[model samples]
Target: MLRQLRGWSYMYEKIFDGIREQAHVRDELRMGLVCDACDLGPCTFDGSTSRVPCGITPDEMAMKNLAEKIAEGLGEYKTHKRHITMVYDMESLLEAATRMVDVSRSYSDEIDKLLSPYRTVRTVPFGLGGLRPEAVNICAVSSPRGIHDLIEFTRTPEAAENIECAGAHGVNIVSLGYPGAELAYQRGIPCIGNYLVLDNALATGCIDAIHTFGSERASLEEALKHFASRKGPQCELPEPKMHTTGATLDVTAINRAYERGNIEGVVVLFGAASPTCSWHMEGLVTDLVEHGYLVLVTGAHMYEGSTDAMNAPGVVHIGFCEIGKMHGKGFAPTPFVLVPGWKNAKILTSTLALVHHGYPVITGVRIPLTPSIEEKLAEKGCITELNGERVVERISELQSHREG
Candidate 1:
């Protein structure tokens, strides 16, 4: 009852337009970032009929050239490992795909080292004074509403406390599949599979060795059958409730969280899959946009990799729908965070997915398209937002040296 009352108070004090008025953020949230200075950049385009392709620097051009060479070396490594010496009849496709595959292998090798405590010296921090030194254990379950997942993990606050006591930094609950990617994005945690059909090989890091005995391969059907057989007819089990509406559930969860006054920020997860799901997700995005909520969509995931292997039409349709809505609303580009299981994490693919859809991702590296809308604001050296009639952040220069 207290929780519910608190939610009501939050709704009144923070969820309404008045909440925006009271906006305040901590100074620790800001960080000095190493500015990127890549040479040969890609062709630049504005939304209209303008194209500028020759602004790339010599260093950037040299880096791109070197990257292409490294790709060739990595392709040779893959050819040796896979025993496909004469498989490539054309050098062009091999050049492109091989470089990506090679870079991927090198990156994976690095992550494996980073995951180990002994390799601490080899680790480099990439964001905000380097990656925050934290390993977050996210206990998540997937059900119809997504709340079941959070509630299950936190059965009691004490139970949640136990995980924290065990050294978990933050908590993440993903009841629905769509939110998994976004939760992983905002929380900066890897998806450990609460309840959906996550790729078994990817989930377990058996992608390169699925045929080997060390990795177990099981289908959704096999899993259900195993569960049912364990029951042995003692009690009849009902059919699981199949959710045909992810978008609807997403909208419902957002509204509920807002009512609870727990939403400080939002990461929108909408894939261009299933026309029905896409339609609903797009609808939610539109609603959130009008309300000035920060929403990001991952439309390209709907059409990439294994995702594209299945629902091509659905993915394209969903991407187009999201694009249309964003264009119409003049909504800013927000990135779709990709939370594929570790070692098999498709961070680059996911980044490319959103870039393909023409939006900045929320949780990962911003795809270099337009200068980030945030960057646009930063051009003035500082920008301010109206919060309870107080200018925020912008006055820090003066406030830091206040006199009596």
Candidate 2:
């Protein structure tokens, strides 16, 4: 109930009731990203303009957007972790994609080694119920780098004095994506909500500010003073509910079940936390599991569900989006992926890099034009379907082939 953005509390009921239904500025993303970087034309390349004053065709613009997103995620690693890699560009899209596939594996291995001891899961509180009306609420809308210090220091008493200064009152990791999951695993730092729940989270009239790293920034001091004095009925938070990560699920049991004809092929699920996408993804899991395939869930999609899904008979909740990326680059025997939406820049670019590697994907996003690299993948190359119905058919057909 805490996750619901609907009318849970009569006091702050309308704060986020009608936001999602609002009309979007653009009709649809033609291929890559909608260009709003300049004043010339905020175009979707809907065949309205022949030549964009931005000096790039729709194809070129898509390629550029893809490269930028990959660089953005990797660049963060460089800044905080001191990780370095050879940087390449526009014409070198294919080479860059190959490098991303290779380097990301190394990064996965490194992070695993550094934090291996904290892998096994346990039960943790899920909703806004744990929130105290008196204490300040600061959501950590953070990245791996941003949340690194708090998790690192809080391990011991002496080191914790540093982070215990401002964040000592009340703090919860809001939607830090993959890093948030990692933080939850390392120490049971409660992650209240993902990207979808941001609006209602702040609207609770008690959330003081956000501790930003990526897109969401913390509130300023002057603004916070008014927050305490602001007039409104504070919504009463529910009693905390228990959610488990491990949830008594095992991967080897899945592999053995596959051998025993109890399960068919394995499918890995990930991507952005769109409510529509998540609902469909959950449905896909239900359909796939019923079809006798073990569905491995991850990213925001995994967290958005009840423990019943996480602990489902044929469903295994993998670590986070890193597993999703690893699955993209033909991890051992490659598995099929369903990326329903790419609203986030990182996911969009990550999808580009995966497709550039010539891996076949079943996504609802329409690239409009295939890249030169995907062109090399040929008849069976990167498939970007726009219709959701056809996406299901494509996966069903592919699953049947795997069965055969």
Candidate 3:
């Protein structure tokens, strides 16, 4: 059986002020402020004495081997695309965290204390728009004005030059865009650059950090863990439900199940690809988030296959694009939370980085392509949403979403 684990989970206190805050009227923008340290999962201390024998062991040799394999595969299949690709996007997750930290930086004493631990947060602005028609704007902004500032601000040549510096220095650069994986394969850089919805994105080592920005949060399992970590024992959050599928969960069904006494918490079992579903289960995420359901979004190709290279020379970089888009529109998640997957090691590292850096993430794997491969992915806890004819035209429909 494949092993599984939760990365980071956060709990939020539903805090709303005044009659306007509680009103269900559509005009109210201040949804509510739910704050609490969600519980994060158990981390493998780089090299621990009591190491578990996962697919990618916690040893540097295993990690290096995996990285070498990925690098070698890219070299062996040097099929290049002519398009200028945008790699990763910071999205709403990063932005919200920055906002949280910024708020914490200014107000709360507890947050001020935590700020020292999160000094690695990126302050500079960056993007990949021009040249690539399909380029995605992958950036992070803390305040409401951050995104606005980024879009309106003029590019200083000095900052533009920093791309070279960032790349050269191996600063875990994230690329946000659709063609990110192809771009990474062509560039030979570990595609830890952008966030995509497919499983291959993870297994291929395309994104280093899978940014879960915007609103709809992780399952109760992850959120509770998140709460425990930052808040200590004073907070009692929900327990994590290890589902058969390797997807992040939502609380809707679990809440219902609780009412029916189906079980204590929710347990989700899922696979990634759907013959009926289209293009990497994009809006399906909305369902997962809205329904309060836990899902293993995909399979090994994305999550387990991703950080399998944890012991590589340097940390890998992953990118997320849409999370930022959703949050920038002024919609706050009803219950904000995040969690990382346990299928791979780098996920833990990335999750820790985001949490430490103030970014919240929902744990999940990317969708794989081949059926047999997807079957293997199922073993790793991925959830399958659509199948048959519906699955065939998924990507084409996905393109429509991009266009529409």
Candidate 4:
């Protein structure tokens, strides 16, 4: 994918590398204990030096910082959910809710039994009572509204796979949003990763049609100009060498997989922002699959092109938001692990949400949690700060528990 884009002088790899390098530099600067309250010298939080010049203890400062980060992460997701809700009419909104309920009901008895614990019916309008209002709102509002003429892209592997399959069946596929271009590449389908890529993809004459959603409309006119200007010979892009032939799993397939005992466990790979981390996760996922685990991935992990991982008998590519909804209803009957490559706020919040829902989540990233939050998670048997080896160890135990 990088090589093909490079032909058009699109420096996506260079830009991403620059961003990652800057992020590392920022992390280095944050290592010092700098007091944000006042213009004071950088203070070291040794046991002897308990308090900073601002009259706050090191523990207090840490807790405050953690709280702010959590708030920021939660706010981002909430705002995204609100934006989806604001765009659709009430009739369309209710139709989405009804569809979800109908889908849930169509499951087999075994699948239904597995979903009963987390199945939400209430707060869905004309359903049984006792569903989480927030969950229902999120699921309903975020549901796809109308039939898309162009390929409406998002941050999900399933979306890319669907687009590719549709295109193969004689449908016009064009990207409208950010990310998942790599996943599309696996199937030999061209897709845009972001607005910049959208411009380039259109200019290359690879995209058949374009559709903009949300704030993407702001750059529509400029993108169209680029699309219109490039009418010369089209470039023949190289196909990815290691393509996986696995089908993307939907909600019904997910339930059926669980009921059939085809999925032993699930491992979510986060923080695909950096090339190095993404490479590491690709290897890790392959290892997990070899050990008979059903590897699940979202975000940039979808584009890693780990053929071995995908070909592993039980691999499933899904969206992060879809997994969050599935968590509410006990999707993984066995234990699962959440692997994070970086200290990302969104990943932290998603991990917390899963832990809050009583899933046996083993976290790979070390998130700074308040004592209360840590204790609650501990009570639920959620472990954090596990390295790759320890994570696999925990998964082995969980698999054993399932078999026993």
Candidate 5:
């Protein structure tokens, strides 16, 4: 459906984050599991159990795939820039799926213990500034790793020589998504937005050269070092509902408001893109609030389809998935919960973490990982089916116990 993100990657002889944006949308929902475990076939199926030539069932393939996604999610911390003592045997999920171990304790304990330090309320400044007009702009998008990569390379003499050649006052850097509020605490590098706004930041025409530094993509050096001016018109970003804007999960505020019946409960959009297929972004959020749940549309979902949605009374645009969504996870035992769309790897980490904490994560997919895990999650919350009505019904049911 999203035909062209950035139309001139070839013109610059350099690829940008637009490619990843397109793939994120494609693989998360549209493409199901594919088993290339055997050379006989890279057979694709709709997460079914029809056995392949390699004797691996789709059920088995799904478990392996799920484990792999968790591993990739954990890799986000490798360059985490801080020490992490907590450990999760994520393979335990696969083991439990196969009945090797009774689903052990949720990973939420470990993740929460680790993230406890980053929980303080903070403002993450976004929207294209902090660049020296005379200097070259070294822009990067993708994983948190890409931010690190941009930092490391921009220091080398090789980079210095290039900026000197351009007669600029050193390179001005911009990092996207990670290290915004939680991880890095707003270093000089200003983050434009989450993964969803990668292309949007590029289209702003303020950035100079884009880099995929933290990416293992080949020839990143060329991209980091190259400058490609836009031949097309820059896109206009709409004014935000608030200026000097900030969004953070205030546990005390939420509880006080709920007790007074200001909100029935909380609904967090965990790495979900909206407006979803069946619902407009604002419509879904407005519906949730009307049902008495305060809706926190988080991460890329905040900007995926913006149209004064955040301006709605109950909606809060918490910046970046890792920071905002993790706060939502902290509410596991308290009843403030996260609602996730099984979108991507970062989302997989957040969703599984919440599931570990015993939140009944409602997703449209009937069988996301395995029937067993889905079944157990369903026990906590109903599996949403058909349209936004199911989700609204679930919200009503969850908040029904509040008695306010």
Candidate 6:
């Protein structure tokens, strides 16, 4: 599995590694102070300097930097959400609502209630011109309901896991964001995340078809058209679904996962990958799930045998953005593990957010940290390694703390 993924991920791994190396070098060169008021000189953080010229402490600077990264992640998700809502039509919306009713009715009354307004509406205008070519395809990938329905709808033998369809020809599945990528993968379509990773995936000479959601459709289509005209190399389609492996968890499913005695706790995993890392991550998740931990995964790791992991009976796949939504709805107080990928500033900031919110998190990958940052996180009782005994002990401590 690692070998195959390595082949697919080579281009992406190089790109990510290069960026991280460049950033690390830049950080090393920085004096680490930038005045908020004037974007002033990078003042040294040596012992001689108690504060930057702006009177900001090292702690303050760290917090500000973290805040900026968090804000950037928030902004990206907001934009994706906006695109999804803006492009969905009433008819497609109704179909999605109906499918939700069909597949999840037994488990969720909230979905029914939430979608009630859309049920009575009819004939929604095609709001975007790009949607006309294959409006259902666009809608199916964009909206939440559409995404859910598409996965359920595609889970048939006739559709197969990797069927060769006219529509899929010369196209690569450039899945936009978290849940979308997870859904596409379950349907036997290979997917890459949005942003820089998405660009690298397209450049790999493997994807001719662009299976994406939200505003990404336009850009991907433009790229695909260019590739098609030039007779570029095409990637082989992923194998069809031989079995139902992954289960998508919404708010209700998440709540139920907790309610059931089967789930000991929940752990959220995040990262992009090299094939080796992907393999190690999967092994770690499998071990955790076997021990009765309900693992909730997002980001690039979602494509790493996530569905197969669900066969362990304790793994629930979710979108990266959905983690905060779940956490916001009184879920933060729950003791869970946050295993972040190494070296990514975005993941680090997210880990910081989880730690700040008082969650017991254990890092799955080694965090690139300064001594100060490491000391601070340690003082807060955040685990920076994937030691099983340590994680269990920390979780017990957090649980006791909450109970008290």
Q: Who wins the TM-score comparison?
A: 2
Query: lDDT of each model, Cα atoms only?
Result: 0.30, 0.52, 0.27, 0.40, 0.48, 0.45
Model 2: per-residue lDDT, tens digit, 169-228?
333433335665555444455555455555666667656656665422223342245345
Which digits, one per residue and each the tens of the lDDT, describe model 4 over residues 1-404? Answer: 88786764657767777788877445423543433321133344644466654456666666656776676568558544554335444333323333233333343233323323332211111111111111101001111221121223322465435434432222322331212322232222222232223334434443433443333222333333333454322434333223232233444555565667565555655333221122245556667766666666544334333332332335454322223324444453533745443323334444445555445676554345567766655565566644555567776765575567
Highest lDDT scorer: 2
Local accuracy of candidate 1 as per-residue lDDT tens digits, 257-375: 44554432333443322211112333434443333333433322221111111111111111111222222232222322221111111333333333333332322123233456445
**Poorly placed runs, candidate 2 (over 4 Å):** 1-96, 124-135, 151-173, 213-233, 236-242, 246-253, 275-279, 303-313, 323-333, 352-360, 370-378, 385-392, 402-404
List TM-scores for all candidates, in order: 0.22, 0.60, 0.20, 0.44, 0.52, 0.47
Off by over 4 Å in 1: 1-229, 232-345, 352-358, 364-404
Lowest lDDT sum, 10 consecutive residues, model 1, at 304-313
Model 6 ranges with Cα > 4 A deviation: 1-173, 176-190, 193-200, 208-260, 271-279, 303-312, 330-335, 342-344, 366-373, 386-404
Name the Cα RMSD for model 6: 18.4
Better of 5 and 6 by lDDT: 5
Model 6: what TM-score? 0.47
Report the number of clashing residue pairs per model.
12, 1, 79, 1, 3, 9
Q: Poorest 10 consecutive residues of model 5 by lDDT? A: 96-105
- Deviation in angstroms for 276 in model 4? 9.1
lDDT of 5 at 397: 61
* Arranged by TM-score, best first: 2, 5, 6, 4, 1, 3
lDDT, model 4? 0.40
User: Which residue segments of model 4 deviate by more than 4 Å?
Assistant: 1-221, 228-263, 268-279, 303-312, 323-325, 328-332, 341-346, 370-379, 398-404
Model 5, CA-based lDDT: 0.48
Candidate 5 lands at a TM-score of 0.52
